[model samples]
Target: MKKKDKFIIIDGNSLAYRAFFALPDSIMTISGIITNSVYGFTNMLLKIINDNKPTMLAVAFDSKKPTFRHKIFKDYKSDREKMPEDLASQFNLIYRVLDVFNIPKYQVEGYEADDLLGTLATQAKDKGIEVLIVTGDKDALQLVSENVKVIFTVKGISDVNIYGPEEVIDKYGIGPNYIADYFGLIGDKIDNIPGISGIGKKSAAKLINEFGFLEQILDRVDEIPAEKIKEKLKQDSEMAILSKNLATIDCNSPIRIDIEKCKLKKFDEKKVYELFEYLEFRKLWEKIKKMNLMEKSLKDENKFQSRTKLIVEEGELINLIEKIKNLKEISIQFLGSNNDCTGIAISIKPDVSFYIHIDSKEKEDRFFNLLKPILINKNIKKIMHNAKYQLKILFKKGIRLQGLIFDSYIASYLLNPHFREHKLSEIIQKYFGYIAFFNIYSNRAITIYCC
Candidate 1:
């Protein structure tokens, strides 16, 4: 039997930028400092650990100075603008988080993250490690080896398509080894790599896979039927060479750090807890304390035990209402669909130890009947991660939640609007420092969180 092996690598800068722009420019630290990118980036890293039980992990970042590629092609990456001033400020906080997680971060002064990733993928493959390179760069495709796979973030880091040998063939219509040649023939407009003038993506893939390389395709110009392609390849010979050099990733950069430095370790709860407290994340504080009990069991080596803490039937109505009446404050977490919920599946918790399911009409009435009395009273301060959505649904049910107090999502946004996402699941993952989850039932397109 072949044992499963997973070696994870990340493009830290790319992931952070994608996450930063994915949400609104919200989420901030105390004292009016923005921490949106910090929040989003940290949650992404946590997501990978909680989902994939990778035996080894590393994150690679770009150096401040120009890489060797820039020296080769002066215009290489020249078109891109500087990162937002707000985003640049939060970069260090993300780095501190990596340190807390005991994850290895690799960077070389003259080498880009692609170089570090290429070298690591090659090294891991030699040692029988199955590498999963997480990056937004297409240049990392060249690093895909037989034992290595690439997971490109598709939409919002919410979904990813795993590209192995077969997937590469299906997706790009070329193998890993031929990606450089393909890039060489068809230029990257983003990187300013000048490819053959007339040759587009379709022609480039065919020529690269058929002739084996950019140089070889040029050599056999007589065989190429397309006169435009032949002329472009012949006339732009210098551009082809430059493009290949730009496209080919430098695997032998001087960044010789070991993966041992990147091992996932215990997050300093005190540091994270202090940060949350400083931000006034009380619900977040509670979630963290709860997960601390299961921290040792969840982190490191990428695994966690998910179990049902409680499940109440439709008949357990009064017991739940009786439970809610005594509580002064509560955290409301709505599960099921985000849309209209008359078919609204709701769950309300007056306390962490007690979560009541309102799946049926009987239980929901008792839960809301108790909740309705409080809706009119302004003294009873209420808290919900997303108060507006809950407000909309609860209002439809004749419950006007008048005096809502706080929203972790809103607080997180004010702290750093650039930090963007606001799902209960992600908020828990970020501020609470725990992996928030909902076991999604595909048929119903419904998500139910198992606390």
Candidate 2:
């Protein structure tokens, strides 16, 4: 069977609102442009692209004008708080970022982003294309099906919960089609949807699971076991129906854009860099640099290739150290276990990579003694991944490692602090488009040139 194309439809307003509140308002640019929402959105967008490798994408935004739901029910979403000024200010900048990436964006004058997502997803599913709806809105759950999945943001941008038909059943105890009915009976105080007065989530799910939908429950209200619950359902029958109408997303919204228009393409790196600079996103700028470097390295593999050697014999170790004694710049990788210094790799130039193993205390002491002069030489630059970890291990061996100029570990942290670890392979793969063949003990030295 042929593979189906993957399309990701995002609810921009829902995610933007969630991101703004999830992050602190203090993430402001140097020019006083608040970027909490923009940063979160950018990260989420990149994460989805990297994780899913979607073939097409579109972000649907809510227009400033009131939606059709407002005309149907004047009090619809009336109780929701207005967007804060700081977050609102970042919307245009976010749009600019999307433009730089060449991603299609859509908004209808009288429809919510959810409706646009539903429409696109429904259309894609019909064409045998898999659809992934990304949002923080629970209303999107109604669109879940065999070909459509909803990725709901659980906490900020890092954690998410994906819902297929089975997940929807597991989470809500009803089929995807019953979500609107469930909300109709239980009510959504957040959206000010007035469901049945006495029904809660459990009651709503039980009724929907037992009788199927809201109309069925209402039609047989008299058969309900609880008299009080039945009385409330009878009294609020009209409101329940109205709530369902409001909660139901219009899957056939008149969205006219062709799916081909949403194909993913290379972004304008220069423009993206300029935007990052203008926003003063220093950490994000580093990431952009890495991405650009990776692309370049992939396009020209030979340009980043270098020679390397691992030394285990004592004679070979001394000779290599002697060869690069006068080198002005060098990179080092100290390999150790249980705080015991075990081996080291040194790369003085792109063509020269050396590694030495310390098999015993005598060998370890002899290696450090021979290399200590170069390490202390202020004129010579030393580079390594996580110099502190190396320094700590050397400290335990009664040696002081110094003259360090670049530490890729701290650099990686500053670039993306959310990552759990900045391993050598991860850094190399991220910046070079392929995993490094050399392990932590072997390739730690050459990472100095990754930036």
Candidate 3:
């Protein structure tokens, strides 16, 4: 039998709030636009995609308009603090990033993100698609069932706890169906839901496990062994019911699931790379590049093949130098260490590159001796990534590298001083719009592209 397709629904507001608090606000773009929330959210998104490999994905965002729960209680989430300006400023950027990924995002005026998640999850589950709900809110646990699981953000944005039916039972001492009942007994301070005066988690779990739900517990309140507990349940019965209603997620939200639209497909890698570059997400780009998530454009794909020639003979090396003798600039990359240099690749033009293998001491000495004039020429400009390392290696070989004009590593750092590390693959993808492959073996040499 074929495996069922996985559909993931994300609570965007809850995740953004959690990420905003988990990461430091010091993470901002060069223009002073705060990006901690977006950074964390995107990080979590990439990780989820890499790990789960979901076929269908969508994000549900909470609308600015008040939901039905607010109208019912008139004080729903009244105690919650206002959203921070820094986090609020990044919501548009987050939306743009989601668009670049082609992930469908929905926001209904009269429902919270939880309601949309519940509705979509139920719809997908009924259609035989495996559903995963990603959120930081515990209120989403009530939606857990056999076919649906909740990926609850436990701490920060990375640490998470997945909850199935049995996991929910283990955590709450009752099944997922009774999560709202438990919440009703013990009020949710985060949402300002008022439960019974003294009921807590232990009492709520016992009451839920004993009875069926909030109504059943209230109906059987008279049979309680403790007088005070029974009195609280009976006296505050209306409040308990209201709290449960508030905690319950509405599965019939005003929305429909478009499976085809939610299905993951190839996205515009160039647009995503440009956005990351503008946002100065150097490290995130590197992570995505390492994961091989970005697809190369047609132009790049054609430019990346069979253009590297290996020169093992003296005649070939002499011809290669003659071809590059008058070139204004060239790109160079050295493989291996100074003492045990394996090979060197040189690009005299956009379409052509040559790798000279260094097997024996004689070959290494001869190759450098033939190329030393160009290497030490002050007029022919040389470009590299991490020029300092290459300069050190060349100096150790008794050949001084001259006319060093451009270093992509330094350029990346200068572009974003906040970045901790600058990688050549990331820089190439960010600016050149594609990754250049560089592979070297113990006995064989492959051409490396430095453009």
Candidate 4:
């Protein structure tokens, strides 16, 4: 199917509520209202938005009632505890977030989100749209089809398993129909489905493969499978039937959702900022600001062109070393492909911000070492963002840099780890809120002259 026809539906309440409890609850407003779930959910939504670049999206929520699956099996999910009052209360904020992002949210009166997802999956398939249903629940696997795929969230909700026919086959060793059958034989303790007494996943799969269907296995019970298997299947005939029914998702669930209605629209940054301000997300609020929610920003004075002049000429080495040693604290920035021997640029800031090129190893080593005394000096401070990588390089060279203060990188991350990559350029932009380096700022400098 064409890309435009693609649709993505998320199990919002399931994942959002999960993210809420996954992180520490220390993130709160000064008033003692918790915002950890809000922040984490927002970050997750932002990442999904950026990655999927979905043309259409919607978040589906589950109803409070026991689903039809549970009616068929009373003990289904009976083990689950009730939702926390704090998390339940936070649902209002998530609802408002949906409004801010301009994405439609849906919650049926009497169905779980999984049933809604299955309903939507069936509808999207009819419309010729490739559907991607994302959730942490593996039970959603029953919805997999040629036109619809299930991407189960794993590894702390960062990655997903894209289950098409092949992936489903590879993983469960059964098709969706057989999947319900497979689970029927094995039973799910969480959902409380009970299979045959002696039957497990392996035996179930083997039997299903041999007979091709659950009814078929029982139809030819005398085809002489193991006596143990035959006796168990005969005795728990009711359980086997009930297990299959419980495992099978109701694609024909009465949840009447209009799939076309889930089409996405541009996010409402203003609304987002308003809620962000209410929750005290100062840094994220500013990030939304720079995204130009107003569409055009005011004219400012910090515009300066970065002219990288590659110096490949010979014999200008001594003069450069002398100039660097005479300066105190250099602001250094490198630009090139290979990080190790990449082209380097260094300059001293405040009045004499002249950038010198370093194309040779001799130059790279010399400039890095020149700041050692300042880096190790308790009275002096050196600043960097994502200092771990850069510091590792320096440490490997036996250049132990201690007493350094102000890592703009970590500061930027502590501000918003979800906004940008932990790169220096991003931190500089976040903290300074402008491209200050081209003129207002410069690169890392290495040492001694009182500039």
Compute each candidate's TM-score over C-alphas.
Answer: 0.64, 0.67, 0.88, 0.64
Pairs of colliding residues, candidate 2: 311-355
Q: What's the candidate order when arranged by decreasing lDDT?
A: 3, 2, 1, 4
Lowest lDDT sum, 10 consecutive residues, model 4, at: 442-451
lDDT of each: 0.69, 0.80, 0.86, 0.66
In model 1, where is the ten-residue run with the lowest total lDDT? 300-309
Q: How close is candidate 1 to the true structure, as a TM-score?
A: 0.64
Ranking by TM-score: 3, 2, 1, 4
- Per residue, candidate 3 scores C-alpha lDDT tens digits across 1-451 of 8978999999999889888999999898768888999999999999999999999999999988999999889999999889988889989999998998889999999899999999999999999999999999999999999999999999989999999999999998999999888889998999999988898888889888888888998888888898989999888899999999999999999899999999987767787778888887877876876776665542464455577777778899999999888899999988777676677888888888888777787888888889999999989999998888888888887999889999888988888677667777655666666665655555453546543
Instruction: Please give the lDDT score at residue 302 for candidate 1.
Output: 20
Error of 2 at 72 (Å): 1.1
Top candidate (TM-score):
3
- What tens digits encode model 1's per-residue C-alpha lDDT throughout 1-451? 9875588999998888887887667566546777667666766766676677676889998988998889988999888888899889878877876765667888889888888898888877887878899988887887786788888887665567778878887878888888888878888987888777778888888887778777788789778888888888888888898898898988787766475665555666656655554554444445545543223432321222222223345445455455546656554555544443322222344113333444566666665675577565665556666777777767667777766778777887876564436666656555555555433332333333323
Over the stretch 1-451, how does candidate 2's per-residue lDDT look in tens digits?
7667999999998778877988998887645688899988887888888789888999999978999999989999999888888888999988987887778899989999999999999888998889999998899999999999999998877789999999999998999999999999988988999888878888888888788789999998888998988999988899999999999999888896477789877775556656765775656656655543222323333343445565777788778877777778888887766456766778878666765756688888778887777776777788889887787777776667667899889998988675667887657656555434433444453232322
Give the higher-lDDT candidate: 2 or 4: 2
What is the number of residue pairs that collide in model 1? 18
Measured by C-alpha RMSD in angstroms, how accurate is candidate 2? 7.3
For model 1, state the Cα shift of residue 110 in Å.
Answer: 1.1
